[model samples]
Target: MDKNDYLKAVDRLNLWAKAYYTDDSPIASDDEYDKLYNAVVQFEKENPDLKLSYSPTNRIGGEVLDEFKKISHIAKMWSMEDIFSDSELVAWILRGDKTDCEFFAEPKFDGASLNLLYENGNLISAATRGDGSVGEDVTNNAKVISSVPLQIDYKDKIEIRGEVVISKDDFELINSERSKNSEPPLANPRNAAAGSLRQLDNSIVKQRKLKFYPWGVGENSLKFNKHSQIMDFVRSLGFLRDDFCKVIKGIDELKIAYKELLSARELKPILMDGMVIRVNDLSKANQLGYTVKFPKFMVAYKFPATEKTAKLIDILLQVGRTGVVTPVGLLDGVLIDGAFVKNVTLHNFDEIDRLNLMKNDFVTVIRSGDVIPKITGVFKDRRDGTQSEIIRPKICPECGNELLDEGVFIKCQNLTCKARVVSSIIYFASKKCMNIDGLGDAIVELLYQKNIIKDIADIYRLDELSFIGLEGFKTKKISNLLLAIDNSKTPNLDKFITSLGIEHIGEVAAKKIAKNYGDKWLELTIEELLSLDGFGEAMALSYLEFMRVNLEKIKELLEFITPKIQNLELKTNIFSGKTVVITGTLSRSRDEFKAQLESYGATISNSVSKKTDFVLYGNEAGSKLEKANKLGVRTIDESEYESLK
Candidate 1:
């Protein structure tokens, strides 16, 4: 057959595939489609260069890889904030002015998040959403998944981010097959789908029968007025979109939709954690922007938590890193949300007082997913005379010092408390703080017990000889840990502040304080801290007092620790104060060029429009190039762009 015949076969097969997988309307019988597909595959094998990206042959598994490579995302993939109660959802909807807002609601599938990048109408890379900004390349594994489109007509450069899920029936079938093979059943569908995607062999992925559902897009060149338009765009490109996805008008609509979706949650083929509510207006959503952890314009209304009743046996006191004496309840072993619960934190005395919990008295423990269990109710009627009221401790359990009752919390205020010092050291070495990789809770405790590290500052004074005398501290392990400690000397300023574990200040508050003050973060005033996001009077007061008492110690640590400098300055350049659109692959990744242009005070946009000042082009540029030409937007190649820079 000639090129025309091969093209016809490929188009027919792709069309039939889209109809079957996406629209649920198969046009041709499986046998009939297979005959044509096999023929096309044979022709493509004979004429490899003539093969098209959209061909049906790509769906059959064949590719193999030794290991997955890391790739950076064009933009950050922020996770949405979750609200479980109707009141919380209502507050989220009403938090901002929303008179003109329309919301997009879709099932929040519980599966591995995947990011698929396409350029010039072809799938270029597929990755697991690893830490939002970077992911492992899974292009070969993705090709075997039937729902993931290999090509689309509208693509310039776009990233389709979605959930890679295993349907209920498919998951059960897979587990049953494993049982017959005398293999252990997979833990759950979510884990099965996640593990399958990372398998080095594509044949294994093909057997998993995974499905892809596009929840959202990352960076894309196509212009969208509303989020619905983006859904439409992906649907047109042959992705299997959620059937329940709809646009909700207001709070009332959102409330109704949430209830309806919750009722039908189990009916879904794929497991859903909840439903996402996003502002439909693209412009309004962008203006709302994001917080350190979540997008302000969007929220997830999580389904009702898996609540199971458990009995609280006793209450115990523990000292935290900040010397706060917290109450923890000892619960009778109970299972909630697949995990066993033995103990739950009481946070403060106020929580215990609120619940009126007593030792040996039955109390209801509420747990959601991985969130720690809490005492929500006390079975007063079932309580026997043997039950004893929980007593608030008058002295610190670790140091035997008189406790200072500061409203909700009780503190040790003893700088040398063994428990507090050890916990503080652990916090300082944690991933979110200094990120000292090799220093963990066990190592910190061992070091503290040996009198090697008594305080955060003491960590800097430790040497190889300190661990040389200890058992299980191998030479290489000690060397790596020492290197990690040395590396943490230059942690981000926000993280360093968070490592201090102030009573009221957390990561978000610490970030706001650092970003606002930058290099002068140490000089932050209580008045200035009060103005930052999420900072209240109590937090500001706690921050000020902590600094006031430990400023000298912090200064001493600063001699050894240098926080990362936060400086973002726009340079004066020809592209300054201009709107620029970048399309097509360049000599380097688009991210590098975009960062360079942004640093030069230029606004980098996705789509070409009348407002666009310059459209940067490279080899294999697609619709963006054409649109720029017709719109009379100035086009510049690599050399011209270099000249401009």
Candidate 2:
């Protein structure tokens, strides 16, 4: 390839890497990206003096760092060269000397790399691999990760490198919460882990339940002859090491390990896109040295990209609870990642404009470690002038209300639109909200369709006679549902605020707001809300505007219901003015424990800080316990906590 071709390849690969690593939205398949990257590498090799500094080959990660403080690495972190097929793996193995050399094979974690520093057995710093030589400091966020040890056995300073990842289960749970709040789902586990760890508030990071697995060391006082020995030492220090790491003898064993990992990728707790094969002997690794961006002794063998092409059958508009309308693409039935892909989300109208997507276009759909399938790109080659342009709807499909365009989103402004009302009612009765049992989506829909319930307030007015003739509604069930509705009349202040579904106000924000203002939050002005910590102008304004329009509705609703607000001033007990952090799996739920503590005048904190007076621990208590110990804060077990009560 010529210089111009190299330049173009460089630009293209950078774009793909940025999308893949930073945005979590990959435009190209892994195979295509690898091929382009290899071409760029070849061109750079041919014209060594003309290599560009900003080439994708020389970068550790493509994320833009603005939130966290930047810290320079004591030793440069390196990425591994990726090989796709068996033949390429064999060729890479042959490139190194095979005399008495063994390979250490482990799953290549598909997550963000974090470098941690320990001084005198205490964790001092945690950082991301920003550009190999510098990283963003995320020590506070890392402290909450259960698998990351807050204190180790080593008394000297050491630097351990690990991958911070969210498990598939936790990723799904987080996405489920995001969906409940009408927020866009994270693209994959890797992106979720990165985004969670980079949060400015460590409390948010704690809720993400991110785990860390140590794979290598950057700087250590202790010496080891083999990579496996290093991993063993790290594991002994209470760090999680890859359970699948194996010391294989030759290329055949390496290939076997690769095949096994690739076949069991979906079965693993964490996401692994491939396997990493490294020279086992530490001296041999040093001898092999390093490339500008990758270690010469190791190669990451990526599994084949999982992508399939399916024709776009139709486009459907999904109206969220907040009235934001999203375009979904209906695709011909195709299997991806062992699941049937019938539909993929187009995200928004801006995405439609960018893709120029249309009906009957053959588009590439990818599952990519997420349950929700996404349309990555359109196949222009298959288009034979038969495809029809997707028409943008001028009105809400459910209520016929005129649509309002708000930058990237088009929304239905009708507050009482059927779709919005149904969704809101369901949310208000959800398990996290009023906890009105038996009032599920089907029941809410049935009531709405029958014109028996028009809004959230209507739910409390339903009579048993209204459900007498409804399908599946027996007399006993109707009585039970009415009782549930009555029970929901008195809810916690946080739950009451959360059930309101104010834009950008989720349960966590609601709790924070309630904790500060108690039952008087409605009395606060927008400027006062903006002055509160963590409240931005947009969020504060949205809250004020929502209250302004819904005050009368709220007053009417209050006539039939009451919220139990916590009065911190009334609790003048022994635990008063104490900040308490809870850790581990307690006998009772965390919420129950929190309520019990708050009733005794204790402030609940999610993370351990210097202000923490006590850390209540239970079985399998993690880093927070160690952090409490390190800070010389008192820690009580569940038994001791109960004794106090």
For all predicted structures, in order, the TM-scores are 0.53, 0.45
lDDT of 2 by residue, 1-645 (tens): 999999889878766754554344789999999899888888888899988754655432234333578998888888677677878777787786754579888888888999999887778899999878899998878776756766566888889998998878878788789889999777677878888878876767878888888889998767789998988888877666666989999777887888888889778878887888889998899999985447889888877768898999999898888899999999887755434568798889889889889899999887754447888899988899889989878899989989998878889988888888899999899887899998999899999999899988888888977876787676767888899999999988878998998988765557667878887878878777876655788888889988988899898889889998864333456566588899975655777887667656567788998989999986446589989999999999877776676
lDDT of 2 at 255: 79
Runs of candidate 1 exceeding 4 Å displacement? 307-367, 370-645
* Residue lDDT tens for model 1, 1-645: 789999999888888988888789999999999899889988998999999977878777867665688989998888677777778777776777765689999998888999999998899999998877889999999998999988888648889999999987888788779989999777667778899999987988999999999988888876779998999878888899778999989778888998898888667788887889999998999888886556889988877765667778877899988888989999886754333567888888898888878888777777654456787788899977988878888899898999898788788998778888888888888876788887899889888888888789988887888887797777777888889889989887877888888877765466667777888777778789878645689898988888888899899899899988665344778898788899865655776787678657676787889999999986446689999999999999877988888
Q: What is the C-alpha RMSD of each candidate to the true structure, in Å?
A: 15.3, 23.4
Clashes of each: 0, 0
Supply candidate 1's per-residue lDDT for 528. 91
In model 1, the clashing pairs are none
Which residue pairs of candidate 2 clash? Answer: none
